[model samples]
Target chain A: MQKNTFKRKTLPSLAMAGPVSLWMILFVTLPMLYIIYISFMSRGVFGDVVYKFSLESYETLLDSTYFKVILKSIKAAFVTTVLCILIGYPFAYYIAKKPKEVASKLIMLIMIPFWTNSLMRLNSWLLLFQTSGPVNNFLLSTGFIDTPMSFVYTDGLVMVGMITNMLPFAVLPMYSSIEKLSRSLLEASADLGASGRTTFFNITLPLTFPGIFSSIILVFIPSLGIYTVTDMLGGGKVLYIGNIIKNQFGSIRNWPLGAALSVLLIVITGLLIYIYTRFAKIEDMEVL
Target chain B: MSISRKQKGKRRQELLGTIYSVAIYTILYIPVFVMMMFSFNNQRYNYYWNGFTTQWYAKLFNNSAVIGSLWYSVVIAVLATVISVTIGTIGALGLKKYEFRGKKFINNMLYIPIIVPEIVMAVALLIIFIKIGLSLGMGTILIGHCTFCIPYAVVTIKGRISGDGYSLEEASMDLGANRIKTFLNVTLPSIMPGVMSAAFLSFTLSIDDVVMSNMLAGAKNSTLPVLILSMNKTGVTPDVNALTTIMILFIVIAMILNNFIRNALKKRAKMEENI
Candidate 1:
């Protein structure tokens, strides 16, 4: 009986857990390890790893060009994060304040665009804001502007794209948190004679602080790393750290430098995630 | 009079809130709506609003490159979904059922795939693939995708598996149904929605992905988004718009179908409980 019991326990663990753990160890963990390993290796003359120990890649990170790229990427991501919160908080508030059915429907509306490929949305933005696009035509016809505005291929438009892409991430967590807020708490605040604004500040904001922080981390980290928006919307004239890293691997053919840049990104993401866990439950980190 | 004034104030606040909601949704969807509308434009360049035509849709349908990449994307998505979901379901069950060393650590590790930026994972996979001399192609792209896709599957399936209060497997074992039979008959049906949802989630994410796929894709095996991306280097056309609309429509249909199945399953469960 003891032997049978032992077989039962071991069988499930081996049969069920073994394949996935092995897959992750092979594909995910090992690949991440390889990235770190290569980050310390020297860049080969022919664009391959040279297998010699060197901090040249990390030194390259301190180069003025890379430093500027990293700084610019952080600024853009910070701007995007702030804008997402500014736009999404009120939107999430509106959703959470609605009846449950209406709220779910509104949430679904937010998600529909989210699930669609972001490249498509960015394409549409390009099309809409292209030279002589509808907005320019309307402004010209309405006498608002004398000529077509240079709306496409601008830093401003890239920021706009980032805001749209990251808005849902900000909204989902805040909305979920706000929905979990007890009506009695608000009612009690009112009963205690707090003004509407006072109640909102005291009761609503503090309660949803975790959601707000989660939104910040979620939006900020991806915005830092996602190059697609800048690549398409900025017309490749601009470069974030993502584009720089991508160029390193693609055109520059510097794998070690690319790996080093990736490690920096990983560090930034890890720090933000560590902060996020401190503020909120890990399970509450909902993007959908 | 004060109560009436308070009620009026609340009513006005609600109205304002509704308007804000509408405005937010409008900003969120205007680009997508514009694209969908422009997809039917008779003109290739979107400078002017030409009369409606299904020409772009027709052209897209006949476009060999678009069709080929789409087929490749679907094949990759389906395979990734099947593999990831099977692994995820099994892993979720294991994590829930078995007490083992590093269980807490494994649960925490689930978030790494999600928390790490896609580019980092993309570069990591690229570096590793090159180190191992695996040629960049669909195979490389598939491995890159599964790296993140497995974690997504685990999150979804594990949530469902753990949320249940009772263990049908334990009950079945008590009744002399063997381990395999209990899992097949009891546990499988119970978590079918989670499995299906995880499958859909992985499939959608895989199909819609661009960065990892682009980084890992070979010259001859461009996915549809990658194809569209290449086209964007020149300029996007209404045909591309039409293609996107189709993809969006396809996903919406898939989601609705999945939701329908979930609802039906819930209703059947309700009936079973009543009986």
Candidate 2:
């Protein structure tokens, strides 16, 4: 009777998990395998995949132009990461310090804009900063400049877009970690002879290191591979690593080269994530 | 209790903290402020304040393409949400209750989709759909969405099930209820918050997707984000601003309705508790 009951319970559990498991293996694992496989193949006369194995695609990736693209992408992503950290850390800190009810509401405010498509947000930025846009017109009216500033499609504007897109990803994780900090530690630091400055650098900063590390990883990796923001805001004038990958598939029609670039992206992301895991447990990664 | 020189230094540090806080909030809000202000602008160029007009909003609603694509987006989002939540709830419960092999692998699989670049996932799925000869349309979009959507739903519901209580379900079963009866009477109510939240989240995410929809869309199956993106590529238009205003209006209306219904239910629940 007990064995029958055990079987009954177990059967349902297995049944429940079965379909989702199969879905994952097929859609996720299989595609990942295909990416690796495509990375090894040669490009055909047309855009078709030629089955003959060759390292030509990987070799193409090693070309100096590719290196410059990778370096530029990294530089942009890095600058964006730093700005996000500077902007996000204290915003998170302020929110975390609020009462629970208020904190959630504040978090909602931060996230509400996010609910709108990111592309919409980028378009709005363009509308706001374009030559005839309000900022330029206002500046012109105020006698700040005789000519309208060419803000859109510039490096500065691209950085602005990148930072705006990534700010939320930086804040949410840091907020979770900072919120979990023990009140007594702050109290104890006060109770002792330590000043607020010493306590923060010595205690609070150290405690929040895990969160800071995650903020870096989350912002850096996505900023590296995100071509849409750069493509739209950069006016297709400047290319990030992401734009290059998109070019291969869309305009360049080099699937093997694209696959190789994607493989490189995957490696970079994996290595960073692995490093982040060393600093902060993956299980503790707060989903915003 | 000690206010020594060291404590003075700490107070100074806190002052620095205050400075840091102000600077950060300014950076975060300035762009948002610009966007919010322009939404109310009368002129087509957000750079100039011609005069305040709601004409953009009026024009937005008149756009047949935006309206049609929005309808399609809503249907696909709803379908994807329903499918993902059902599968996710069952999967979360299964993962929570059972000691199964490959649990680790399954857990990692879910995380991979969340962290991997959306463009990469979009391309990979597109290639696979072509390789397998799956017809690209609303169906492909729905399926592609669910592959990532179910993972998020699963992870969320798993956290919810693990927290709080499951004792009610155990007791209900002990009192001679069948498994289905126990679930209907106990498990469903317990996880309803999770279910609602997960559904809300999935709907929001589905509506926001551009890359995946663009990759998998049939010639006829354009979503609002895709339409907006194409229009953007052409150049700025007052129509987009108007369309955006209309979309924002829809979202605000939805939020207000949700709040009203939730408050009514909460009031009823409180009355019952008092009784």
Candidate 3:
């Protein structure tokens, strides 16, 4: 009787979840499978999928140009990640130590900028830094330069845009983790005669490693795949792996190549995520 | 009760804290301030502020293409939000309240759409859709959006679902309410906050999305972001700045309003406690 009653009660909930599960399997899992499959398929001259199995795309990935692009992507992502961490860590520590009400307000400030469209934000950066813009005007007026310095369409500008875009993602997780840290530990460490610097390095840093890991993943992965900021700020001359993949599908009409590139991107991202979760508990990485 | 060198150390730390805090806030605000100031610049070029003017804003309103794309974006955002919330609420409840085989696997699968690049998802769907003879249009864009939207909704709703007090549902069921009736009367109200936030998030995400929407939108149905992107490619224009400024203003106002309402409620609760 108990078994029957339990089945009756639970059946509807199971049914409720079933459709969503199927949808996830079909749309999310199946497409990922398809991407992997196409990565192995031969590319035809007409840019259509040729059904014959081959490893040509993976082989092409070994070419120097592709290697350079991948290296460049990694370097760019690394720089962006470093900048975000340096800026975000102190900001997060400050907010975390504030009273609860004040900390919440500061957190809201970080989030409010994020709520604005990322593309729009990128565009605004373009406007503010355009060669003839106020920045150049100010510099020229100060006699810092006789001519307006070329600002947009440069790698440095792209990095600045990327760092701005990703700063919040690094801050929020670290703030939460730092906030959760026990104050008594600091008090305990001071009592033991350790210098403040030593206490911070030994105690606070170790406890906050999970947040740092989250900041890296959250910043690095998106910075790797996002073409919008780079494309806008870098003036389409510079092509990250993301812009290359986008071009293949959009302008180049090379679906198979795009699919192959995507498969590679996914594989790299998945490996990183797997490594990250191993190093830091997945539950500890939740940002929100 | 103690006066020592430790107090001196704390004072130095506070002084250092003030300097760092001031520098960080300046870094955060400067770029945004530059953007906001240029919005009202009378000069056609952002390089010079000729004077204050609203001409660009006027031009933004008069442009038919911009208006059309904005309307379509709004419509798609609303539809996507509605569909995602319905599916996500059901999915969250199921995950929270029940146990089933392969549940862990299923839960992980939901995250795949979110973590994978949108270009990958768009291209994969494009290949499949073309193979099956599905034409690109509003329907395709909506589906593409929902694929990403569902995961976000599930995550938000799942958080709230786990925190809910379920005794009301148990009581309603014990009083001979059917499962569906009990869910409506007891469970639904408790989960409404999750649903609302999920819907809000989905709407914002859909409206801001350019990658998938750009891919899925056919010749007939270009989105606002796409239009702006092409305009940007054409070169600098004051009209684009005006449009972006309006979008920024709308988002900031919405956020401030949300915070204001939340603070007001908190103040009321404090007063009630005192009384």
- Top DockQ model: 1
Q: Could you tell me every candidate's TM-score relative to the true structure? A: 0.96, 0.91, 0.93
TM-score of chain B of each: 0.91, 0.82, 0.86
- Model 1: per-residue lDDT, tens digit, A134-183? 88888889999997899887899998899988899999989998999999
Return the TM-score for chain B, candidate 2.
0.82
Stretches off by above 4 angstroms in model 1 are A1-5, B45-50, B163-166, B253-275
* Selected candidate, larger TM-score, 1 vs 2: 1
Give lDDT tens digits, candidate 2, residues A1-288.
988976786688678888788889988889888988888998888888998899999998779999889898889999999989988887888789878998887787776667556776787678778888877889999998999989989889888889988998999989988999999999999789786689989998999989988888889888988877876788888798777877777767888888888888888878988887776677677654
All candidates: CA RMSD (Å): 1.9, 3.0, 2.6
Q: How accurate is candidate 2 locally (lDDT)?
A: 0.81
Q: Please give the lDDT score at residue A50 for candidate 1.
A: 92
What clash pairs does model 1 have?
none
The alpha-carbon deviation from the true structure for residue A153 of candidate 1, after best TM-score superposition, in angstroms, is: 1.2
Q: What lDDT does candidate 2 reach at residue B52?
A: 72
Off by over 4 Å in 2: A1-10, B1-52, B163-166, B256-275
Best by lDDT: 1
